[model samples]
Target: MEAGKHDRGRSGASIPGRFVAEAGLTVPRTVLIVSPYFPPSNLACVHRARHLANHLPAAGWTPIILCVDDRFYEQDPDPLLGSLVSPELEIVRVPALHARMTRRFGIGDLSLRAWSALSSRAADLLSARRIDAVLITGSPFYPMLMSRWIEPKFGVPVVLDFQDPWVSAWGADQKPLSKAGLSHQLALRLEGPALRKARFVTSVSTRQNEELAARHSWLDASRMAALPIGGDPGDLDLLRAMPDIRRSRLDPAMINLSYVGTALPRSHGLFRVLFKGLAEMRARQPGLAARLRLHFIGTSNQANDSETFSILPLAEAEGVADLVAEIPRRLAYAEALGLMARSHGLLLVGSDEAHYTASKIYPALLTKRPYLSLFHRLSSAHALLAAAGGGIHFSFTDANGLAGLPQDIAAGLERLALDPASLGQPRQDHLEPFSARAIAGSYAAIFDGLR
Candidate 1:
């Protein structure tokens, strides 16, 4: 149970030793990873690259990260995140056009602003080194375009990793001339060219891979990898070691349940369902509900936008406003974990999209506290949480399966408020499959096949 040792004998543990070439020379293959939002910038997408780079060496790939300098990020940087990065990794930071300079023009994506500098720097490294592959992870989907550009000139295979679906059906209901509609159209125009020369495409779930395959007839199952960004035990270990970081937000004396991360647009229905359950709990078990406090932290997508709150309004609508507390502004990476660690339990609400995967579940599982997870029945997250055991999981379909959702949520909240110990800990054997090291091994397999 050492810090950073989540996979001592678990499945998908890294293979020990260096890779050998046909000439019997022992050396790890090099991969240049294009990650525009890297550490110190506490955006969730950074963990995908951070964890991959931290563990890829054991899987026989040396990663050189190409990222935007932290100075350009509009969000306040987290120094703690910088400490979590592997000291051995090589990180190259290039200049990007600051948001201040581009906000007037309505161009805010860091990848778009950093495109020229990143591409030029990448070309220099490719020409100078023996790089075996290029992996561009996105949400700043614009950088994936480098795949189409890089492979042709450098003769290196490229992998485009998506933290989310590039072209989504989420905004289909918006007006044609609206911002969401315009963005969707632009994604439709760009995705094809970005993927035009990629040797392989990767996403967080199999459902997402299927979406990609369906969108592009040329993309087959064999050309894709579904790799979830599972939790890093090292994060918990680091949180435990940092004495300065404290859970000042919640009271230990009160029965508190925390929900962290941004609440998506499609998750509003789920929130209403959860709030209704709270209202039901208040009616049926007022005394128990009085002791329970439901917290929603970082519910807004914009980190510093305290004015934009998503969960509280719904809680007010359900008449459970007294029971619910929301902090729309984002917390630093470690501080968020500290709040979770001190809480009596965790709460996870899923999107209506079945393909949506909640990456936060991995870390919550590591916390060993009781969690109430409400997800679409077909979501990859629901399946993962159910298989691991311990948590209270309620799955619903978009249509008829939701009739009983409020009662289920009410019952789950009662157990969490009264007899939390009955929920037990997630089985270690079951949890190992979603560990960060295991995820890195999966990525290594896909990289090996491409080369």
Candidate 2:
């Protein structure tokens, strides 16, 4: 809700809603952040809300996080992540249909389970508080429909933040009656109306914004912004303080290179190229290959499912299984960061989609260790690495572009195995623009303009 000239606190004295450091403008506004997956749930998408809530206060906005209660979450809760949320932040958790009940009906998406609950709570908050804006983020893309629903009743503007594409041809090959295809069809029907009424839109990459614009011709270029979910240096600090958390998965005796995150189904081709390169390295430089160990941790997005392995099968097919270890179960957020922190080097593989930007690059950059990224030439991650002077990036255009990948991967592996320091550290100056604080300022700027 938009604040008046000032707002009254619990003591009933007037408090400035917003304080501009330079212009001395005191226009405090309240923004409700509707994110289904939040802290303790430990899904990576939660950080977008977590970091924003912590820093938005400085930008003259008081953020209220509206999330589903962690108890109803399908993923295992990580207590360490809960500790990282700011004490000052206002978080309201709402109940959702329990996953067990929903799972029986083949309806496990959090957005579907919690949409009515979120809608009810959001209406209550808007009615009670002086809310100026509503920012709805999605993985549970259904909540974004509230953008159209809330504004009409509450008289507040809404912004839709896309962490991933709501509508895409990603699973087009699936039978139309299948769950994935049905969801895609539903998205096709729903996304346009949900977006049409939004005050503005924002995404993590320029390509996503561009795609949204192309799909909905009415969306103007100025109505959208592309900003990465930058890393929080405080996360590293908190990670260091938690000694008992499983920190490093890399072997100290080996030349450890780690890739920590879910290996998407679309990323199979990228892995094929990478493993083929490793196979070549093993054949050409047996001694160095023996010493090098590549760790693909948390390759499965599903929690507590160790039986299914994404990278292991690929590695075996490429005949480099000995050099690669695939841990399919998801890891705690801090543990993932710790693995990157302790690694001799990091491995970043991008998706087949040119528009896909790996937001994990921000945290990887914060680790200060060299990262060798295999991405499309147009991927924002490639540009980010270049701008930050972080590490080596191998960009491919098409099937033909990947023809040299095996050789490139072989060379990169050899270099990291022998003279890792030659890659040099990422420049901190260039990285400053991508801090969590700066990202909040950018979000605030968009919020400030909508009013």
Candidate 3:
């Protein structure tokens, strides 16, 4: 078969004219997407890969996903996510090294364990087919390292997608540990070669792109693109089908504000600042304070291991423990959206790190519920929320900004509680660039250029 043209099977159905036009030819270019987390894993990492795989077909590219087998995941699987995978798309699953073995050896993660298998499968696929390019998304940054192995063997261009920084500097909230610093140095040393070999790189924020470029002088600035994470339209449809669960859980008499998703280690300081601001607001206006409740869903202070990190201690220190409610376990994507839909307002919390953009921002904006965000002045989310313009933005790092945060949050809550409709709808035009379809197109452009 010719490149970009796959066999249509026994029926031999003719290729659609629109697909040919969109592709700028009769055949669609093939790009392999390597992600350690995909459908049924219910991981935040899966959404971007899922969105890319779902929309790339229309953009004149065929996505063949290579993901970890389901048996490797520790989290409960969400079968509904599998529905998003199109029948035409091909998925290849690689067996993962047993979690027990990985834990016992203290060697990286499941991605590291399955590296050999992944490398072998990816090589075989490339050797047998016409793969235009390879795109690898990271968190299990291990899979990205495979580019060094695959690129040299198959001679296919490689693109590295940074969902989060592979090596993050320890923040103020994080205790300075010698071991942690050493690990960061080791990861950077290992990551340097593969990154240098990549033809293109993409990150969720411009700050991250800048940081990576600054860290690696060999990296060409022209080859990097900032591609933000976006909400899946199908997820929105699922939310519409579910009844508003927020109303049932929230007290009608109280003004409810909610923050969804897990709290990262660097976010502890910001949460402390927010809870302190809330306490100050409560002291001045006891009536409003009495009627206010802050709900945290799918959040925990201690995310991994036996380490206990509960935000309740901070809430108690801020004297708002009674007003706080915590749900420590993560909910399914659809369930989280239902919680957002019923709440009067949404809360976005970001770390002091400039490159740290909350992945939840896009979905929260899509809910059209009024939102209040606290982020570092330098954070990409600060700029994004300001431009989006439907919500309040507070800079947590500045003393002046910090002083007014409580009042800002209070005013936002009052507005949402009294008249949510007054906050109006999110500017869908501003939201267009962050839509999954648009982001997929951006990736397609990169793939096409590389091809």
Better of 2 and 3 by lDDT: 2
lDDT of 3 at 389: 80
Give the total clashing residue pairs for model 2: 7
Model 1 TM-score (2 dp): 0.94
Model 1: lowest-lDDT 10 consecutive positions: 1-10
Query: What TM-score would every model get versus the actual structure?
Result: 0.94, 0.94, 0.89
lDDT of each: 0.85, 0.84, 0.77
Q: How accurate is candidate 2 locally (lDDT)?
A: 0.84
Put down candidate 1 lDDT per residue, 1-451, tens digits, no spaces: 1111111123333223346575766666888888999988999899889998888888888888889888788899988888898665677788888799888888898988888888888888899977888999998899888887788898999999999987887866667788778888899898988888999989999999998888888886888878888998888866765566365689767899999989998888888988998999889999988888999998885678888878888999999999999999988888888788888989988888989999888878878888999999989999988988788999998646765689888999999888889988888887787788998888888888886
**Candidate 2 runs further than 4 Å off:** 1-27, 244-248
> Which model is ahead, 1 or 3, in terms of TM-score?
1
Clashes per candidate, residues 3 or more apart or on different chains: 0, 7, 2
Model 2 C-alpha lDDT per residue in residues 209-289, reported as the tens digit of each score: 888888889998998999888888888875675675465466678999999888987788999999999999889999989
Cand. 2 TM to true fold = 0.94
In model 1, which runs have C-alpha deviations exceeding 4 angstroms? 1-17, 22-27, 241-245
Candidate RMSDs in Å, in order, are 5.8, 4.2, 4.6
